[model samples]
Target: MAEFSTNDSTNFSYPRSDYVEIVVVRHGETAWNAISRIQGQLDVELNETGRQQAAAVGDRLSKESKLSVIYSSDLQRASETAQIIASRCGGVEVVKDADLRERHLGDLQGLVYHEMAKTNPNAYKAFVSKNEDMEIPGGGESLVQLFDRSTSALLRIGMKHIGERVVVVTHGGFIRSLYKRACPNGRPAGKVLNTSVSVFHLHVEDKWVLKMWGDVSHLSQTGFLQSGFGGDRTSG
Candidate 1:
C-alpha cells in the first residue's frame, strides 16, 4: 500500500488556523440519475427537480457563515450546482477542478443499473464486491485510485485555504470514497442524496475529520429527497 500525505510545510504554512473547513456536496440530480443510468465522466445536465434541489440547498447555505470560495468538479452537474450556490452566496468565486470529477465507470458508463449485471457480470461483480484495487473494465480507475485522486484534490484545496470555509461540489462516488478514507471505522449509513451536504475538517498534518454526512435537511419540502437509484455503488 502506498502512503498518501498532503503535509507540505516547504510550500506553505497554516498561519491562520490549524484546520480548514470543507463543505463537501454531491451534485444535484440529472436525467440519467432519474433512470439510474451510469453517468461516470460523461457530461449530464441537471433535471428540473435537480435544479430546484440545488436552489434549495443554495438558499440554505447562503444563510450560514460566509464562504471564502466554492470549488467544483469540472463536470456539468457539479459545476452547475456550484454556480447556483455561488449566486446565492454573494457570488463567491467558483473554481473548477478536473481532479474532483467522479470515478470513471469505463465500459459500464451509460448502462442502466440492472442491465450491468447481465451485460458484464464479471465487472459488475467486481464493482459490487467493493474491492479497492479492482479497476473497472475499459479504462476505468479502481476504488483506491478514486480515493487517492479525489482526497488529494480536497487536501490541496484545504491546504490552500487554511482556516477558511469553502464548498466542494462533486459527485456521489467521490463523496463515498472520501467517507471511506475520512472515517475508516465508521460506515456510511445510507445513500448520498443529490445535493446533500457533508462537512469535513482538514488539518495541516493531512488528517481529516468528517463533521457531518449525507444531510438533505435543506430539501425537506422538495419531495425529491429520494436518493438516485443505485447511488454511489452503481453510478458516479
Candidate 2:
C-alpha cells in the first residue's frame, strides 16, 4: 500500500543521467471547460481561445529552449496542443502516450460540476472526499491509480530522454497528482491554469526537483490568462 502513497518514491525508478528537464503543460480550455462539465476521459477539443493559448505557449517555448521531443496524452485536447507546440518549436516530433490521459471519472464524465450532487451524489461525494482509495462509482479510478500510472509513465519518458528538455501536454488532474508527489508536505500551490507551464527536473534514483509550478505568464500578454475549469482538485 505504501507504494501507492503520494509520499513514497520507492516504487519508481529514474534514469542514470544528471537530470531530465520536463516542461509540463496543461492542455488549453475546452467547450466542456467553459461549462464546468467534467471531461474525464472524454475526447473534448480545445475551444477557440484554447487554440490561441496553445500558440502563445508554443511561441514562448520555442524562444525559451530547444525541445528534444514532445510527449502528449493521446486525447485530442492534449495531442492537438502538442502538435501546435511542435510546429512552433521547429516541428519537433510529438509522441502520444495514453498513460498521460486525465483520470477516468467513469460515471461523472460529462456532468456539470455544480449539478454533480443532484445527479450522482455518491460519486461526487467520493470525488470531493479526496480519499486515496475511494474509487468513484461506475468505472472511475482512485487517486492512487492515477498517481501510479502518471508517475510511471513520466519516469519512463525521463529515462528515454535523459539530459534533454521535453514538453508534456497533459491534463490538469495529472499535473496535480505529480504536484503532490513533488510536494509531500502539501504546501498550497496555486491553480493549474490552462496552458500553464510547470518545470520538473528528474535526477538519478527517482529524485525530482520542481523548478516551477503553474506558470501562466505566457497567457497574460495574450489575454488568455484565466481561472481553471472544474476538477482542479486532486480528482477529475
Candidate 3:
C-alpha cells in the first residue's frame, strides 16, 4: 500500500462557515471505469483497487467529518463504497437511494465511447459536446434531467438534516451534474475522479455552496489514482 498524507486542499471560493456540510464522494473504480465504458444503471461492482480506494476514503473521512448518516446509490459499486466508508465511520447508517445512481443511459449502457459513436453518432456527438439537453436514442435521460433529479434529491437531504454532516456515495456523472448545478458559472470540471471527495455546504440562506471539488488526496496517498482511459461519450 502506498503511504498517503492528509492534505485536503482546493481552489474553490466557497466560504467555510457555520452550516450543514455534505461530503459528496464519487464511488471507487470499477472494471467499466478503467475502460471508460458507460455503466449507467448496470450495477457494476468495484474492482480490487476500488475496494482499496473505498477503504482509503473511509479512513480519511473518519477523522475529518462529523458524519451523521450516509446516503449511497443503490448500485453495487456505490453501495459497496458506502459500506466501506460506513464501516470506518464507526457504524454510520447507510441508506440506499436510487436517485443517486448514475444517469440511466437507456440502450447506451455498457458501451464504450467508440462503440457509442458508431451506433448513435448524433447522440454521441451531442453528449461528448456536453449538450445539456441531448437525449439518448433509447429512452435515456438528458444531462438536464440528471442534474435536476440528483440535485433535487440532495436538496431534500440537506433540508431534512439541517446543521448535520452526511456522506453521499454516488457515480461520476451525477457528481458532475450536482457540481455543475452548484457552480453554474464555472468552467467544465474535467473528469470526476473515482474515490474523490467533493464538499458542499447548505448555507443559512438555503443555497448550496461548493466548498471543494475532486479532492483526491486519499487516492493519491494510497496510489490508487490512475489515468489514461479514453474520454466518455455518453457520460453515464
Best candidate, TM-score:
2
How well is each residue in 81-134 modelled by candidate 2, as lDDT tens digits? 999999999999999999999998878898987798899999988787756888
Q: Which pairs clash in model 2?
A: none
Ranking by TM-score: 2, 1, 3
Off by over 4 Å in 2: 1-17, 230-236
Candidate 3, residue 51: lDDT: 94
Stretches off by above 4 angstroms in model 1 are: 1-16, 229-236
For model 1 the TM-score comes to: 0.89
Alpha-carbon RMSD, each predicted model: 5.7, 5.6, 6.0
- For residue 67, give model 2's deviation from the true position in Å: 0.5
Report the candidate with higher TM-score, 1 versus 3. Answer: 1
List candidate 3 segments past 4 Å from native. 1-18, 129-131, 225-236
* Candidate 2, position 41, lDDT: 88
Give the alpha carbon lDDT tens digit for every residue of 1-236 in model 3: 11112234332223344456789998888888788777788878999989999999999888775688999999999999999999998999999998888887767777785587797776666566657787776777888888889889888887777767889998777887776777777777677778888887766575767777878877765564454121234333
What would the per-residue lDDT of candidate 1 be over residues 18-41, giving only the tens digit for each residue? 888788988888999888888889
- Estimate the overall C-alpha local distance difference test score of candidate 1: 0.81
TM-score of each: 0.89, 0.89, 0.85
